[model samples]
Every structure is written in structure tokens, then in C-alpha cells.
Target chain A: MSSTLLRTVPALRGALRASGAPKAAGAMASTSFVRGKATLPDLPYDYGALEPHISGKIMELHHAKHHQTYVNGLNSALQTIGEAESKGDFTKAATVAPLLNFHGGGHINHSLFWENLAPASGEGGGEPDGALKKAIDSDFGSFDTFRAQMNTALAGIQGSGWAWLVKDKAAGTLGLVTRANQDPVSGPYVPLLGIDAWEHAYYLQYENRKAEYFDAIWNVVNWKTVAGRFEKT
Target chain B: MVNIGSLWQYLALHSTLSGDSTNTNNTANNLAKMGLAAYTLPALPYAYDALEPHISAQIMELHHARHHQAYVTNLNKALESHVAAVAAGDVAAQIALQQVVKFNGGGHINHSLFWKNLAPAGSEDASVAQAKGLVAEIEKTWGSFDGFKTAFSAALMGIQGSGWGWLVKEAGNGAGLRIVTTKDQDPVVGGDVPVFGVDMWEHAYYLQYLNGKAAYVENIWNVINWRTAEERFAGRSEEKTEL
Candidate 1:
């Protein structure tokens, strides 16, 4: 989700070179000023779909309020950066970088997270099979071992963060990685499945026993999405 | 390990003496106003195990030694960086460092107050009678002490993320008491007096209470240092010796 703007930058420059001077100037406007606002994506299931594992109230607040704040932050940060840069106030533009990173990463992470979840009554919990399962087994010895390792990583986070099942794009090997705060998985890693370890993720339902929330989330894991991302990577 | 002098100095210099909390964005301004002195972890008022049974020694040790220390350490680092940024005329760097400053700064401030806000369960300060003025104000504001407890507990539970619930004295002429929650590491800045604060972050209770946070909240009253709340409420804490 965050890569959209990044991917457009080079493409916009390419258009500028390919067009005539008048069209090139027009392309410059789009490239320099136009920004697509990040929007909160709709959840694939009802707020209560993952109930008993994650409560409806948690889901509602997480999606509607928390996620919405990130979206607004990202848009506001981008607007500030754009306006600052246009005015030649690089300091102002640079000052907004942290907000851009936090909110942008937050927007992207939550967007992916909502999709990676489904109702436990449907395609939620259970282990992945086929190629994804084969890769997990090869990389981590077995599926159970992989799940346990992920849970360990989740538990080990000292503060707000996430544990992810990621595919190393270069090696095509599966591994576990954790990020502090809203940092999104980037570089060569493709996040297959992410488990949010932030207190808000489970403090309401699981309270301080976050391990229960960690263990229970697998009941609605949505391995189908995990498999799709795994194969595509 | 409880250094009474530094705690007194901290409370005197920062929360009360500063007397400039009205602007919500005044954290950086306050840091500059104070000449950007480094912050150190204030010693707890009691031994780690003093609040045991209600709050375990393990929780207090980790909460104070680990969590609060990190905030103090990080806040000083952010301040140092901000100093260098200001010297070099690096506006972006200075601005970029504000969030960390606010977070770690608030963390330091809140934890400092939180430590002094608690006492050993059976200690004299733990009794409501020690907080005579605050109790009268609480009864006036909420109609009854039980009512205030119920409302405060609800506020604590209602926090969606890591934060603190504070019983504060409104800054204006009325000086009314109110329950408020600040998200993440944000302190009850502005002119309001945070008579007492409850750390709602999972680290404060997760070790002993597990998913039973309600039990922790209920048990907390047994350890609350109402004497400190009374001083803060009566506005006598500014005198420094009242505590």
C-alpha cells in the first residue's frame, strides 16, 4: 500500500521525458504536486467475525478510530511536505519526515493486516498447505515449529511492535522478523502475515496475557492470504 | 535507594515551579525554558517490595528500573540531539526530534509522579484519611468516594492503548477535580494539577494481574499514597516541605 507513491515517482519522471516540452511541463505538475491520499480499506469480514479470539469492540476501534487516525496523519504529512518543498522550505519538509514515515507505515501495515484476517467461521485459522507449507517446512523445520517461533518473537517485543512471517525476496526463504512501533517491513522482505504486538491489539481482549491473544489469533489467521502472498513473492 | 532530595527537587522544579503547562505543545518550549538540563531516573519512594501483594516486587522493579530508566535515558538523548540541532541551525532535525522528546519527556514526568503516588499497602499514607482535602474534593466532585473509584476504574479500563489515567485539579479558579486519560506517554500537561496518576500501561500490572486488570485496579487503592494526593490537591505541595 505504501509503495504506490514510491512506484509512481519513477514512472512520472519517465512520462516527463517521453512527452513534448508543453506536455512535459504538464507532467511535471502531476509528478511534483499530485498525491493520492491513503484511505482506510474495508475489512473483508464483519467486526465480530473474529470474535472469541478478538472481540468486536477491539475490531471496531482498531479499524474505525485507530486506522483512520493513521490515514489522516499520512495525508496531512504528505500535504505539509509538498507545500513545504514547493515553498523552498526544505527544513519544514524534512521536519515532517518522521510523521510521514510513522503514519505512512501505519497506514500500509494496517491495510495489509485487515486483509490478512478473516472470520474463524470461514477461511480464518489452520495451517497453510501446498508450496507455502513446503517453504515453511524447509525454512523452519515444521509448521508447528514456525508458529511457536513466531509466537516467541511476538512475546519478546519489549514494547509496541509487530512480528511478521516474511519472505526474503532474494532467497525466497521464509523467516520471522519483528518491527518496533509502526515500522513497515521493507527492503528485500515481503511480509506474508503480520501479528500486531501493540497493547491495543490485545489489551482489551487478552489484557496483560498477550500470549493468549497471540495464540488465539491463529484461530482466524487467514492462511489463504498468506499462501497467496507467499506464491506471488 | 530512595533519594528523597532528588524527588523533591524534581517535583519542585518541573511540575509545580515551572508553572507553564497551559500550552499543549509547550514540552519543547519548557525544555528550552529550563535550559535543557539532562533528566535522570528519580528513585522510588519505597523499596520494590513495599507494595507487594497488591503490586508485586517484580512489577515495581521492572517498571521503575527498566521502563522508567529507559524513558529518562531516551529523553536525555533526544535533548542532547535537539541541542546540537539548534546549534547547527538544523530546523528539520529539531522539529523531527519533537515526538521523541514529548514521548520520552512525558514518560519521565509521569513515571516520576507515579512512583510517589503509591505507598506500601498497610502504610499510614495508604489510608484515605491521609488525603483529607483530596477526599473532600473527590466527594464534592463525584458525590462519594466509591463513585470516584468506579469512575476512575472505568477511565482506566476505557484506555485503548498504553497510557495513564489521572485524577487532576482543573487549572482555573474553580479547581474542580476531574478524571482524564492521556494516550501513550503524554502527561497531563497544561495548568492542571495531576494530584495522582495511575499507570495503565500493561507493564504496570501484566506481570502480577495477567488478564485480570480489574483486580489490579481494585487492589491499587490499597497502595495509593493518598497523602501525596492531598498535598497536591490542597496546593500546598508547591511549598516543597508539605510532602
Candidate 2:
């Protein structure tokens, strides 16, 4: 299914260039009447919890402003996509394509990012136990090697993208892939975990060098949450 | 008889001599490569203030000092305890600590990649070039040079969130090269060598693009150090088959 994008094999390279301008989410919303959508979900821990790794300033801004922007933008996009679908203008829906992708992506990314982080207490951020540990060892050879690969690839992302640990059902193995823009994995793969690499996600604290942020992000990754994800899948 | 560090150094020295000077220097690479005693935070490549308006000095300040530092410190602590357990033969503690190793250690590894990824924005173009062999390979991998780029951009723009667009080799698999996308902390495939990658993480481009990641991805192509990638690819091939 993921290969379907490739299957069409249109002159996709140059065939899909936009006018190089985005219709503002606000502008898109001005035309719609979707009652301004859901608010940013409350982060479980206080903004200060991930401090030092993530600054209080950055946390406050990221959750309040940045995440909020995504929430607002996502609602706007969904409403626009809805309207476009109703008008039977798939092309018009496509015009707001970047916004839909961006805002929708932000909403999804932050939601996961927030849920995946927690305090390093007994109740949260606990180290992987039982099956998760076994899986890490078996799959990546050793946890150290697994961490090395993940961190390197995660840090290696170019612009605004995500690092994901997805389960490829066909491969029947935990697969790792980074998607640029807000593109998530599809079909057989389910997102076991995700890390947000958007500047707004960490720039206030991490600055131009995202590696700092990426490094720090591990401190708060809620492995128990991952364990739970593993249980369900 | 050789430790992983020396093993890597010997390989890297050979690579550098053969001209892949872009390889990482003698920093403690990862938790496994260096025992707990050896790990410390890596120093930054460029000055904190280098990226400037493209990225603020203030942001770099905190990002490096506080954020990256935490990863280094915690990774060391996590490994030290793990190693102690390992030496004492406490398999459970050692096993459990692997999670910490990945969480903190991965952070350090990823950050190191980020530091090397950027340059002074506009002037980054000077560093862009690849060796002749790699250029032929690029031509072979995805048709013409422009074809490779268009495909790469499409992959990049198609991405969903906080991820990466990578042009990577399939390890020792001689099936030529492939385009890959990795989620957080996912390594390049098995032994696949990563020659060039673009961080689509927001911090890499947010100051300029806002949510317009496509703009950021397109703009950075001008700054791509193709020369660096060329050398890396050449070095990988050379290391495997020595003169």
C-alpha cells in the first residue's frame, strides 16, 4: 500500500509543484464554520518536569503556543478538507495540502510526543521491562547498538520531520523510518513510537543544533507507554 | 586484540588517508564502543553563535549546554551502573539498563549528527561536491542528477512529522543505493551506511519555514555538501576493498 504512491508513477517529480505559497490556516478557517476544534491536550507532567533536558521556557512555549498552533491549524485543515470534499473539489482540497499535512501532522506528532514523555519515577519513564527489553535485544543486537542507530538516525533528520519506530506487519519486525514533512507510515506498519523533531518542538531550548534536543528528549520518553503500545499490538 | 575505538580509528585513518576526512574524530562514539569510564559530552563543531538569525545564539546556548549535557551525563550514569552490574554479573540490572542506554545514549548520538549537519546557512554551498565515482553511482541510482533530486524532494515533502529524509546505501548489499526515511532513533538499515541526510525536524528549519518544511528542504539542497557525501561513499567502498 505504501508503494502505491510509487505505483502511480506519474511524472511525480515535477508534476506536483504547488504555486510555492501556502494558504494561511487562518485564512482557510475564515471561510469555514467548524467551531474552532479541540484544544491542545493537557500534558501529563508539568512543563517544568522535562527541564534541563527541555527548558521550562521551551516547554511552556511549545505546549502552549506551538502545540496550540498545531491544534488550531489541524482543525482548520480538517474543516477545509471537509468543505473541499463537499464541494467535490479534490484539487481545492489539494491546494490546502501542505496545511492539512502540516497542521494535521503537528496535532498527531505532539499528541504522541506528549504522551510518550514523563517523569523518571517509578510511575513514569520507567526503563523497558519484560517483552520490550527482550525485543530490543533480539532486534537491535544489543540495547546500546539499538540506541546508537536510533539516535543517529533520529538526529540525522534534515528539516521538519519525525523519527518513528514503526511495526511493519509484512516484515513482521519493528521497522524504523523517518518521514519528512508530516508523513507517517501506513498499511502494515503501526507507529510504536515517534519523536518530534520540529523546531517548535525544541528550538527554544535546543536551538539550531537539534542533537541537543534529540539527546535530551530521551530522558523523558515514556517507555512504559511504549510497553503498553507493545502489549496492545 | 583491537578495541572498537581503535578498530574504528584504524578504519577511519585509512578512510581519511584515502580522503574521507568528514568522518567523526576521536570522540567516545557510543555506550558500547566506550566503557562507562570513557564517556563524556562531545564539544560542539561550530561556535554557538554561528547560525545566528537562521538559528539564534540563545537557543544554541541552552540546547548545547543544558539539553545535550543532560544526555551525556545521564548516559554515563546509566552505563556506569549497567557496567557495574555486568561486571558483578547481575544480568537483570544490565539488561534493564539497556533502555536507559538507548534513551540517553541515543540522544547523544543523534545530537552529534545534528552538529555536523549544519553550516553558516548561505555559505554552506562551498562545501558541496562529491568524488567522481560517487557521481556516477548517483547517476546510476536514480537516473540523472536532477532525477535523483526530484525523487529525493518528493520523498522529503511526503513525510509526516518529526522525521528525516535520507539518501543511504544498503550496507554491503550491492543492490546499489536506496532512499530511506527513519523514525526517531531508528538506525540506518542494518549495516547500511548513511552518506547524506537532511533533518526535517522543526528546529533545523522552523526559524525560516514555520510549517513550510518543503521550503526548508528545498532551500537546504543549495547548501548540500555533495563533496562530503562523495567522499563518504568513496571512503566506504575503499575501506571495504583496500589498495
Candidate 3:
């Protein structure tokens, strides 16, 4: 119960104590929120879980190295943000702004992304369900068609960006938006689905062939996780 | 006055009220949670032969081969360089490479999705249901598909820099198909899903439309498979709330 309330706030100590999740509240009071800033999120599968479609080498590079870089960069940015805030140096804070947005965004995204994939164990090892599924159908019209559109958007990204199935916050809608760089998805939305079009995400196994990778990614998408996220949001 | 995004959201609500598929897989079903910036290239939904003629075998070949491939190679190199620099503890390199990492990395991600955005561009049956959804959304938002065509075209033409014009979900509320313009690789959503997008980048049209982003944007719609768009719209209506 206490855990559910933590996600919305940057701090939980006072809130917890006020709410009476005693043990949790005490623990929150005793701990720091940014323990390590960013760290490698635990992986749910072997690095080779999506092999053939997504190679082991690519996984290693992506998670171990790329995501780690985001973590580290995010940490550094946060540290700087703190220092600048202390000195009342808005300029310095601003200087570190993009770092916070990009690397920080990377850390957050990779974290969600990790849970969004699944292995091909059954009907779709990691396919979506519940409200997300109903939403997918209502929005895209059908499962097969959704796949095609996602593939197209995944393939259509020009330059560097992400293909996303984002939920609009203010207007309460779901729509597709392509983001440039590590830009946080705009329009105040929740990420229902995300596709990394970055080359490193698939270059090794698929080589320069991105289209091939799109087909295979379906084999491992974590629909359960995505469906869960949909439920919560 | 239900907009495209809201129309889908409303549909999702209806589906939820009706009660259909079980959602057990979504929360726990993740085959792999790969990185958006890591090593994953999307595969083509259709074969090279699949999108011939309207798209041309030659265009697809070069675009994917030369253009898209370059993004992959460059992005990897940037990562490699960043790793080495960080190991050596070079702050200068880290700062300098930030732009390289974002720009090149962004390029790789964007183009990958773009490839799949086009199928044959001529197929009328590619997910006819979704296409109809797009049409319906168009009508809902702008009174008709033709109105959607004009608005989307105008939005694309009005973009001042290299970027994209998207029909994206409005965020937590549900899908309100808003025509948004994002500049210089700016992301359409930090939260919502990016279902369909039109590239207004010069590279996307220079070879074809050259300076006329309007012409290119207009022409691309000719190939728009409304069925696919409708499918995406239908999926947007997919419910998360249990009945």
C-alpha cells in the first residue's frame, strides 16, 4: 500500500509518516532517494533471450554499456544539479539541464523498456493484456494491424529518435509520437509502448537490416509488463 | 466533438465495459526489455519485394542500405568512443561526445521506424480496419477524412525546420489525435505512444520533394494505408481498465 504512493513524489519520508505506513515511513525517513543515482537495472532474462531477432552481442552492448552510460551520466547530472542548486547557480543548473533530460531520460526509459520485453515461451512470451490490449484494439483496430503500424513507425524514424505509443496526459488520449534524441516524450503522456530505433538496439544480428529486426522484436515484447503499466496508469 | 485520440480512448472505455481478453501476460510477459539506445534494428514487416513500384525497389534498397545502415554504424562508433573516453576519465570527450551520441543515436532510432512507416504505399488493404479508424478520427476531429488531409498537410508544410508532424495520443487522458510538430529530432512523447508520423526532414524529401516539404508531405499521404491507421486507432481503443 505504501509502495503505491511513492512513485508520484520525489520524497516519501514525511508523506509516509503522515499516512502511517510506519515501518516504510521510518525507512523512508532514514534513507536517501538518490542512493546511487543510476545503476544497472536487473535484467529479467538472459542476455540472449531474444537471440536471432536481437543478438547477445547487441544486448551486452546495450545494457551493460549503453544503459550504464546513461546511468552514470544521469548520476553526474544530478550531482551537478544539486551543487548548482546549493550555490543558487541557475545558469550552472541550466547548463546541466540537457544532461538531466537526456541521460536522465535514458535511465528512466531503459528501466521501463527492460520490463517491456518478453521471451517467446507461448502465445507471445511477453505480449500485452487487459486494458492495454483493449486499448490497442480500440486504438489500432486489431493486433495484426497494430503490429504493422508499430513496425512502420519503428521503421520510419528519421535520424535518431524513438517510436512510441504514448498516452496523452491532459487530454486523456493515446497517440504515436517520435522523439528526437533522448528527449522525454512531450505532451504530458504515459508511455504505453516504446521501440528503440537506435542502430545498436539491433545492428549486430540484423546488421544494416532494420526491417528484419522489427519482425523479430515481437517475439520478445513483454506484453504482461506493458499491460500492467497500462492498468496502473 | 470527439477527437481522434479521445475517440480511441472512448472506444477503449467501451471495450473495457464489454470485457474481453485476459491481461495476465501484460504485467509479467516481457520476452526482452531491450534498450532504446542499444543494439536492436527493426526488421521489415514486408520483404524487399513487398514494397515495390510505388516505393520502388531501388529507393528502398538505397534508403535502407546506404542511409539507414550509416546511422547504425555511426551510432555504434559513438558508443565505442564514449566507452573509451569514460574509461580514460576524459570529461572533455564526454561533453563533446554528448551531442554526437544524441544526434547520431537519434538518427539511428528515427530512421529505423521510418522504414516500416512505408509498406508499398499503394496497398489499399493493409489493415483496412485501422485505416478506417484514421478516417473516422479524421471525421471526428475535422469533420471528414478530406479535412484531416488538409490539416495534416498544412501542419506538415508549416514546420520550419527538420523534424516530424505526428498524429499522436494526447497522454494519460486517452488518444486525442493532435497534430503536433517536433523540431530537430524532438520527441513527440516522453509518455504516449507514437503510432504514426510523417517525416518533414529535408532528407526525407530532398531527393523527391526537394525544397517543397508541402509537396512531399502531400504525396506521402497518397500512399497512406488508411486501413493501417484505422487499425492503430482501433488498438488505441483497447482497454486497460478491467470490466
True-structure RMSD, every candidate:
17.9, 15.6, 24.1
Worst 10 residues of 3 chain B by lDDT: B27-36
Q: Write the per-residue lDDT of candidate 1 for residues B1-243, one digit (tens) a residue.
A: 124534554444445323433332344455665576456678888999999899989888877887787787778667756765554556788898898888888888889888888999888989899987788888988999999999999999766446899999999998899999997788887889999999988788865775567898899989899999898888877522311
Q: Stretches of candidate 2 above 4 Å error?
A: A1-30, A34-233, B1-37, B49-66, B117-127, B173-175, B207-209, B236-243
Give one digit per residue, the lDDT tens place, for model 1 in A1-233: 12343355787656645765686566545544455867766677779999999999889878887788888889999999999999999999998887887888888889889889989889999889999999989999999999999999998664577889999999888899998778899999999999988876776676556789999999999999999999888
Ranking by lDDT: 1, 2, 3
Which runs in model 1 stand beyond 4 Å of their true positions?
Answer: A1-191, A199-227, A230-233, B1-36, B238-243
Per-residue lDDT, model 2, residue B219, is: 69
CAPRI grade, predicted model 3: incorrect
Candidate 2 C-alpha lDDT tens digits along B1-243: 234534654454334332221222222333334332445566766788776555656556666786667667766667655644554455687788886777666566656555555566556422445446666888988887789889999988765555567777676648477888765444354676666776654545554455556666666665465555665566543322210
Residue A16 CA displacement from its true place in model 3, Å: 30
TM-score winner between candidates 1 and 3: 1
B1-243 per-residue lDDT for model 3 (tens digits): 234544554454434332321222221111111111334445656666565444445445555666656665556556655654454456687788787767656666556545545656556544434465556666788887678778878888655335777776566665677778776655554755555677665445443332344556666765554544554455643312110
lDDT of 3: 0.63
Ranking of models by DockQ: 2, 1, 3
Candidates 1 and 2, the one with greater DockQ? 2
Considering DockQ, which of the candidate structures 1 and 3 is the better prediction for this target?
1
lDDT of 3 by residue, A188-231 (tens): 88887677876557654554567988888888787777766666
DockQ of 2: 0.21
